[model samples]
Target: MEVICLEDAAFYTLIETVVERIKEKLSTTEDKWIGGEEAMRKLRITSKTTLQKLRDEGKIRFSQPEKKIILYDVDSINEYLEEHAKERF
Candidate 1:
């Protein structure tokens, strides 16, 4: 019984570690980019003005085409998360 529990715990830990690694890889993929609505959802913010503010502040890494549409890089998003994650309100 104890041995079974230990094996289960090890399996859970290994799974968690693999999941974390995959998440990191996905987050850092240079070609990975999400559109506006999904990006906003991930960031947990809905302010159009706030998005603009980030652009103006150069806090977000994005590409512009035509006149108005903005596309954000996944790695940049990850970097932003890492930078802002240290603070909590």
Candidate 2:
């Protein structure tokens, strides 16, 4: 085995760099809106009608900034899945 050491300042800098990278990764993954196709893929569904149904029924959250453009909330989709998840014995 080889030994390596970092000084106090260097060690703190390294830790800060790692924390910043983690924050970047988390912010990217926590995207607030996704297009219909991506939302469907994440929910493992193939029907636009079904997706619309869920949106219409208020089972999921979505936004329509324009008449024809829609974006689903990622957090709402995740919550929906967790709420409907089946329990195991």
Candidate 3:
């Protein structure tokens, strides 16, 4: 077995590529994503309530009884934030 680390830029590029592929697959469907607390914090730039609200409103995506998690579709969050980011800016 081999261990792959994300300390290198190449690894990030690979992650990006994979995320793009996943995004393409998800684009054709109306799917909800489950993001980690940190990523959600970064996306919303706020506390848990707002994030939960976004999830509740179906404006973003997630599940309840939240905990520290990382099973997110990064591409979906990126797209959602990019589309709605200016509201914060």
Candidate 4:
């Protein structure tokens, strides 16, 4: 095995680069809004009624800009899932 050492400035620069790359990856994975079908898929539900119920009960955040067009907030859905997440031993 070979050991390589980095200088203080070089180590800091490497850390900053890794952090920026992680942030870029996370930002790309995040979504501000999604359609009902995509939201349902993310939540692993198949019924439209279940999705509507969640919206009706305010369990999730959504917006209806027109008579039939609705958009779900991705952040709210993630929050809901996190709130219901179970602890593992």
Q: Write the per-residue lDDT of candidate 2 for residues 1-89, one digit (tens) a residue.
A: 99889999999999999999999988775569999999999899999999999999999999999999999999999999999999999
| Per-residue lDDT over 1-89 for candidate 3, one digit per residue giving the tens place of the 0 to 100 score | 99856768888899899999999988886334545566566585667776666656766555445465534455657778788756644
- C-alpha-based local distance difference test score of model 1: 0.76
**Candidate number of the best TM-score:** 2
Off by over 4 Å in 4: 1-29
Question: Which candidate's lDDT is highest?
Answer: 2
State in Å the error of residue 3, model 4: 25
Global lDDT of model 3: 0.65
Off by over 4 Å in 2: 1-27
Clashing residue pairs, backbone N/CA/C < 3 A, model 4: none
Candidate 1 C-alpha lDDT tens digits along 23-62: 9988874357666776676677898788768767888777
| Per-model lDDT | 0.76, 0.95, 0.65, 0.95
| TM-score on alpha carbons, each prediction | 0.56, 0.71, 0.40, 0.67
Query: What ranges in model 3 sit over 4 Å off?
Result: 1-35, 63-72, 85-89
Runs of candidate 1 with Cα error greater than 4 angstroms are 1-31, 87-89
User: On a 0 to 100 scale, what is the lDDT of residue 33 in model 3?
Assistant: 53
Point out the higher-scoring one by TM-score: 1 or 2. 2
